[model samples]
Each structure stands twice: as structure tokens, then as C-alpha cells.
Target: MLIDRTHRPWLIFSGAGLAVAAIGYVMYSAMVVGGPRGGSAVGLTYGIIGYAFMLFAGLIGLRKKYPIVRVGRATTWMRGHLWLGLLSFPLILFHAAFSLGAGSLTRALMVLFIVVIISGIFGAVLQHFLPRLLTERVQLETVYEQIDSVRGQLLEEAEKLVADLRSALEGDLSFAEEKQRAMAASAGTVGGLTFASGLGASEFTSQIVADFFDQQLRPFLLHSGGHHCALADKGQASGMFSQLRVQLPRNFWPKLADLESLCDEKRGLDRQRRMHHVLHGWLFVHIPISYALLLLAAVHAVFALRY
Candidate 1:
């Protein structure tokens, strides 16, 4: 269940009631029969009901695959799947008479079922907490599938910013040099002044800006995960940008600010991508094992009936 609102209470109540009823039936069978044997009539009934619940639980995945089918609200199906899937384990245990059956195939099926249940529960727990964590942390949250394209756009924006800064700095440097030349020529004619200093400062600042982008900002923004870059470390990025701000002229501060903002956005995108992975990673384990469990259960059913 999600961390925000509680899941439907009635669903939980109904599943628990049914599970309790099934448990009572199992107890009755245990008393009536010499013991709760898997091949007994009551045990077969439990197996059929347990398999039905498993089928219903598996349909939730199918429903997700084709969401256009409006049989019911998705939340309804998910709630049912979660509760009934949980309930199926107890039913299957009842079917097995709380023990593995007398054959290797039965034992494998039981092990597979246990693994499937554990994976499903693990996935449920992740779904419950990870979304809330993401909401709290990533204000710049985006559709996960679009993260790559968004990242490319961010890189393009950063490149354009650097290009604009380069153009501005070059223009300023040219104007400064031209002014110094005029001053030099006038002073030589007048024979009253030597060459003025600080003519090359803008040029030096431009080089620093270019190197900063090429070495740090560009690589950090372009990467999917920000782990390898120094700017990925917020403290390091802040300090590096602070040093660059002190080095560059005051006129370039606005552009430097924009670059810093872009870096921050890139860090948010990186965090979002990682959290998205944490959110969905468990499906890799839960899904395939579920199908395998169902297939093995089918084979076991066939063999059990034949014998």
C-alpha cells in the first residue's frame, strides 16, 4: 500500500475473514481425516481455491499491461491483488497440509511459491515507501521515461549559456584591447603616459570559464547518473562555483549563476533517475518468478491428478 492514504479497509477485512474461514475448514478436515493429507478431498478443494486466488493476483499484471480495459478502477484491482495474493499463501499451506508433499516436484513447487510470495511482499514494501521519499526529495521530478531527453535538453541549455558567455567575454576583451591601443597611441603622441595595466584580465577569465565547462560542468550534466563528477557532490560544486565566481569579473557573475542553477537541476535529475530505479527494480525479481511459480504449479497439478 502507498504511504499516503490507507488501502481499502473492507478488502482487508474480507480477505482476513475468508482466510479465517478457510483455516477453520482446514482444522475440521484435519480432525475428520486421519490427518490433513494432500490427496484428501478437502486438500484438493483448498488447492483449487488457492490456485484461483493466485490467478486473480496474476491478473493484476495483465491489467497493467492493457490498462484500457475499464472493468474496474485500477486501485480496486491493486488492492484485491495485494490482499488476495497474500491470502493465497495461507491457502496453499492449507492445501499442502502445512508440510511439503512426498515428492521432489512438490518440494520444488513449494520452494518456488515461497520465493514468489517473499518477492511480492518485498515489492509491496518498496512501493509503500519509495514514492513518498521521492516526492519529498525531488521537486524537479519528471516523467521517468523522459529523463534522458530532458537531460539532453539541460546539456544543450548549458552549452548555449557557455557559448553566450564566450561571445560576451570575447566582445568585452576586444573592446578593452582596442581602448588600450587607442590610449597607447595617444600617450605616445603626447609623451606623457606608459602602457596601462589589466588589459588581459577578461581574456584570462574567458579561458577559466571555458576550462570549467569542458572539464567539470559538461561531463556532469551529460551523464545519466551524477556519481562520477565532482559537481555531483553538492558541497564540492558550491565551492568550485564560488571559486570561479571570485576569479571571473563582476560582469560575468550572472552567467556563472545560470551555470550553477543548471548544475543543481542536473543533480536533481540524477537523484530522480536513481530513485526511479529503486522504485521499480523489484519487479525484475517478482514478475518472472511469479510466472515460473504458476507454471510449476500447473505441472504439479497435472502430476497429482494423474497419480
Candidate 2:
């Protein structure tokens, strides 16, 4: 979430808490005999409080997963997650006495904790910036889950436009073979829509538009096809559509304009898809590792206390 005025109280609280903990740790370290080790009363107190913060941070995931358990407002939970989760890192360091670890389990816990904190920070940074970027860039944004359905709708609308253009140009094809030959011969012309021998200008233009749609535009509209198409590049698509406008009659401009609009919307959807992935993909790493960290930490705490 954006770091705004709402975060002021949490920021102040986290900063003050860290300061107090630092003072306590310093005093405890000075009074302790062999230094404030994990087994000492003061060290144990640090570890317990640090772990409590961690547990609280982890519960945010559960809070999100089951919204029915309404213990607090989501914004409050999120603020706690961000600030307390960050606070946990330093508190954990204090618990460890700034050492990596004395055993394999402790070392593993430290590693996992470090990974979790780094991933959380990365995710927070993305969350802070990507929403604004998405709003500015993807004017046609739809719900992420509905992107495919929206794309399909856009494809259907484009297909209807092409079909209507073709229908409007339809006439008796007594010399259909000759027309095809003429189209093939004039393939080198602007989008292959030249006024060829024995072919009506409208018929030839309609055929060219249909061919362009099938060969290039259709793939661009498909879910996995845009990457390889010229239409995927804004500059190239604009140039191609401009050529179409110049080659075809003014009466067909409206349909071409509508087709371009559909393509633009499809591009916006593609952009939103990419931005959405960037915004959320880190959770795949952060969430799983966080759960593992908590589990391993619990194991360490039990073994340390018991043995």
C-alpha cells in the first residue's frame, strides 16, 4: 500500500519501539557476564518479543485468506504487517545478538528470515509504485481475472467489423478466378489493395483488409500471439493502419478506425497483464518462505528451550 499520512502513527510507533529495544539491549549487554547470550534471561526476553512480532506479522496472511475472521480493519492489519514485519528483522537481529547462529537450525532460521524480509521489502516497493504506473498507462484496465474474456469480446467486435466491411463490398463474382489472379499480381502494391485488372476497387480493398486481418491482426488478438506480431509495437501498428487508411476509400475509414480502437484496447489489456504480474509475483516467493521461516523458528525455539 501507498505510504501516506495514514502510516504516520505506525511509523512513529515502530521507530520509538526500536529505540527502546536498542536501549534495553545495550543495558542488558553491559550488565551480563559473558555478554547477553540467547540463553540468558534478557536474551530470552528479546527472542520471545521478536517472535511475537513475527507471529503477528504472519497472521496478516491468515487475515487476508479468511476475511470472515474480522478481528481488525484490513488497513490496520496491513499497516501492522508492513511496519511490524520490518521491525521483526531488527528485533530478530537483537535476539541473535547480531550473530549469524551457533547451530544448523538457527542458521537456517536466520537465512529464511533474511529472505522473507528482503522479499517483503521488494513487494512493498512494487506495491507503492506499480498502481500509479498502471493507472497512467493502462486506460482500458479490466479485472485481472477477466482479461481473457475481455480480449475475446474485443476480437469478436473486430471480426464483426471486418465481416460488415466485406458484406458492403460484395458483388457478383463471375470472374472470381481472374480477380484472385489480379490480387496476386498486385501483391506488391500498398497492402496488396491496388486497382488491379478486372477487379473492382472496393472488392480488391476488401480482400486486402481481410487478408491483413487474417495474416497479422488475428494473431495479435489471440492470447499468446501478440508477442510476434507487428501490431504489438505501437509505432509499427500505427504505421500499418495509416497505410491502410491511405490505400482504402474514405467510406471505409470508419471501420478501419474502429478496428484500430479494438487493437488499442487489446494492447492496454496486455500492458495491464504485465503490470499485474510484476505487482503480485513476489508473493509466490515471499509467502511460502515466510511460512517456512515461522515453522523453522518454532522448531529452533523448542529445541533451544528443551535442551
Candidate 3:
């Protein structure tokens, strides 16, 4: 998937095989009476070999589907799928004598093959680079399916932090101490700020913090919240939090910093979701079309043999 050094052997083998096939096709074309026709023995051999490569490539899906059944190493199958799949295209062209088929079924198969190859290449490129990009961008990445659940947890955590801060600001030392202890036990430290003994601030500042969280941060954390929320943008969120910090007492800054960290984590999750979609989205187009191509190719092969 990463297209690293492990791919080297497959790449070398594929390149060598392609070169040999190209050479054979060239010699066969030159020696043929008119041109290398698909019905010719050499051309038929080319088609068979190309189709075999395609079948092997398509079986990678089956390999994935039944991963528990160890036919071979998955990495081997994947490498074969990527390299042999690519090799099939040029071999298929050689089989067709570099012409789009004159018949409707063959033409359709050719078109479908083209689509599959292009989509496969696109997917390969994405797999090669998007993983590294995802790693660099999403530090708090979680399981893709668990993103919603994690977001819910983050919301709860933010709410608890806000309540603790509010209690501290309102001079409820006992409640704030209990909450801070709970926070320390659960989260330890947030954004490098340790949970300390509650520092008292004005009830007015607590109300403003509560109002800001409800109006801006809470909506941004909600499941149905759209990207139109101001906190969705990093610079805008930073500026808003900066302004909120100016209004609040210095003691409340740690809780606010924790809130900002939570928001940043949420943003990272959102980014991971989008990138995950992009990473696999090509399969929606590639897979179904590939199956169709394989089916039509079978039909074409049968028709060629019979008629």
C-alpha cells in the first residue's frame, strides 16, 4: 500500500515481463502477412496472458474478502494486484493490435478496461501519498468508524471542564475541588496545563464563558453542526479564543486552553474523516466497473472462441 522498498521486486519483475512481451509483440507483428490479427495464434496468446493477469489482479478483492483464508501473504497479493494489473493494460493493447475494437462488445470491454486501469492508477497514487499526508495532518486520528463516538466523548469532556471552571469562578471551592480532582484523575493534564486547586474568579466571567461555550463551542461540537460554525476554521477559532481569554480572569485561562485543545482535537478528527473518504472514494468507481469489465471480458472471450 505504501509503495516502499518491498515493491521493488514486483516492480522489477513487471518491468522485465512487459519488456519481453513488447518485444514478442513487435516481432510477431512484423512477421505477420498483413498485421497481427486478434484471431492469430500469437495475438490469442497475448489476449490469454493479459486476461490471466487481469484475473489475478481481480482476485486481490477475493483475497481481501477472505483474509482469514491464507492463500498467500496479503502484501504479495497486493503487490501482484498493483503491478500485474498495470501490466495487463499494455498487454491488452498488444492483443488488440493497438486498435479500439471494431465490434460493440469488444469496444465496450476496451472502454471498461481503460476506466479500470485509470481508476486503479488513481487509487494507487492516493494510497502511496495520502497515508503520509494523513499521518502528518491528523495527530489525534482514531478509527474512522469511531469518529462520531469520539466526538461525543470530546463534547462530554468539554462540558465537564466548563462546569468545573464555572464552579471555580463562582467561589464554590468544595465543588470545584471535587471536580478538579475528578478532572485530574481522568484527563491528568490538558494542553500542558495541570489541574490545580481552584482559583476563584467573578460569577460574571463564569457566565460569559458559559455563554461563549453555548453559542459557539457547543454548536461546533454537536453531531449535526455544519462547517459554517466559526470555530470550524483554525485561525478564526484561535482569534475567538484569544478574545475570550482577554475577557476572562487569568486563572480561567487553563480551562479555556483545555477547551481550545478539545476543539483542535475535534478539528483533527474532522480532517481525518474527510481524508479517509478521499482515500477510499475511488473504490466506489473502480470496483463495480472492474467487476463489469471482467464479466464482459469473459463474454468476449467466449464469443471469440465460439464464433
Candidate 4:
């Protein structure tokens, strides 16, 4: 992951600090209370320290929301969020004397805290790899929000291609008709001429092209979520275009090739959209749960102090 080297020092520092705190808690428990107890002064110290780390980790989210705050490098804040956030778990366990609290509120806080930590870890893992997947797989990637505009442009191009194909085919038919008339006039015999060698064949070809566009290309280009369409599949789209090249005049082959490329680019953009959604989707689960966890922890702390 790109974050490895930058986060290494932070990871080490947090790990060492946690080890020291755990050892100190162990020694104090052995010397003082005969066992670790959450009500003890040492346990309260561990709780305060752990909660401080948690608060710092949570602030990273605030920092992201307001980048203009200019407190520190985002990378530094991210590293702290990752390493110190992980360290908070063990510290909180130490605070509770490695026991689940007896009260219902404390149990709920523990469950919520575990869910938040697990979701954060899951999100961090996704961030590490999803960007690389997007870069390698989506060469024509654009801003996700701009996809609709780009899609409309692609649709316009596809429509223009169909129009050009029809125009070119009609022009071919007119030329063939003119040439046949010239031949018949020279020979002075029209009754023996076969219809297959003239305008009728070109008209047939135009109809075939029009039908293909209406049935296949139009739906693929004009619809939202064309990713589900047959043309969105690379092999199928390529084969369909190959068949089109065979059916259309050789002169129109280049335009068919260009259309194939546009389709592929549209497909790539769709993939990028899906991947971008995946990269962010976890936050929907993580953020709200984290806020809930924090709120529960605050309430638990208040009740503990009062009772």
C-alpha cells in the first residue's frame, strides 16, 4: 500500500506506547488491588488515555470535512487515525480490566465500539486497493458526477454514426442507379437487366443497417445503466461490430471501428462509476455507527462517574 512507509513510524510509536501502558496496568493491578478493577485510579487513567486517542482519531474525519483548517498534513492525520485508533481498543480493554462491563449500557457501548473499529479497519483495507484497481482498469475514467454529460455525448456520436451510415448507403444506391441507366441506354435493352446488380441491393443493405442500429446500438447508447446491455460485454460487442462490418459497405468500415471504440470507452466509464461507489459505500456503514459508538461511550462515562 502507498501508506506503508509514511505510517511505519506512527505504527511503531503507538505499539510501543500501548505495550508500556499494558505493562504498567498489569504491575499496578498486582501491587495495589490484588486484581485489575475498572473503578481504580489506574483504570481511570487508562480510560482517559484511551478516550483521548479515540477523540484524536475521530478528529481526522472533521479535518477531512474542512480541509481549509490547515492543521497538519492529511497523511499524518490518516496515519494517526489508523495506528492510534487500533491502539485504543487494547487500552479500552485495559481500562475495563479486560472484562465486559456488568451494566447494560456498558455492554451496548462495548458492542458498538467493536463494530466501529471493525468497520474502520474494513474501510482502510478498501482504500488501500480500490484506487489501484480503478487506475489500472479504467483508462478513460472521469469525474463520477460528469458521467451523465459524457454519456450524452456518446449517445450523440452513435446517433450521428447511424445517420452517416444511412446517407452513405443512399448515395451508393443513387450512384449504382445512375451507372445502370447509363449502361442500359448505351445497350438499348432494359428488359434483360437483373435487379440484384443495382439499387435494390443497396436499399436492402440500408434496411439491414437501420434495423441493426434500432435493435442493438440505439438501446445500448440511449439507456442509463447500459452496463447490463449486450453491447457492454466486450466480446459480444466486438463480434457484433465485426458482423456489421461484413454487412455494410467496405467504405463504412472505419466508422464502424470508431463506434466500437466509443462503446468500449463507455463501458470503461461505467466500470469506474461502479468502483468509485464501492470505494465510498463503506462509509455509509462506518460513519453513522461511529457516531453512535461515541455517543454511547459518553453516556457510559457519565453514568460510571455518577454512580
Best-performing candidate as measured by lDDT: 3
In candidate 1, stretches whose alpha carbon ends up further than 4 angstroms from where it belongs are 1-6, 22-26, 29-34, 172-200
Q: Model 4, residue 221: displacement in angstroms?
A: 2.8
Q: Candidate 4, residues 197-272: lDDT per residue as tens digits? A: 3333366677887887788777887776686688989999999988887886565677788789888888887888
Candidate 1 C-alpha lDDT tens digits along 1-307: 6733456584667577576857777576758747776677877877888898898888888898999988798888888788778878887888897888778988888888898889888888888888888888888889988988998998998987776566445543232334434554333211211222322345666788899989999999888886889999989999999998787666567767888988888888889888878778878888888888888898889888997
TM per candidate comes to 0.84, 0.88, 0.89, 0.84
Give the alpha carbon lDDT tens digit for every residue of 138-257 in model 2.
Answer: 997799999999999988988877765564444323323354334544432222222233235556777888898998888899764377899998899999999999877665687788
lDDT of every model, 2 decimals: 0.77, 0.82, 0.85, 0.78
Alpha-carbon RMSD to native, per candidate? 6.3, 6.2, 4.6, 6.2
- Output the TM-score of candidate 3: 0.89
Segments of candidate 4 deviating more than 4 angstroms:
32-34, 172-201
| Model 1 clashing-pair count | 0
Better of 1 and 4 by lDDT: 4
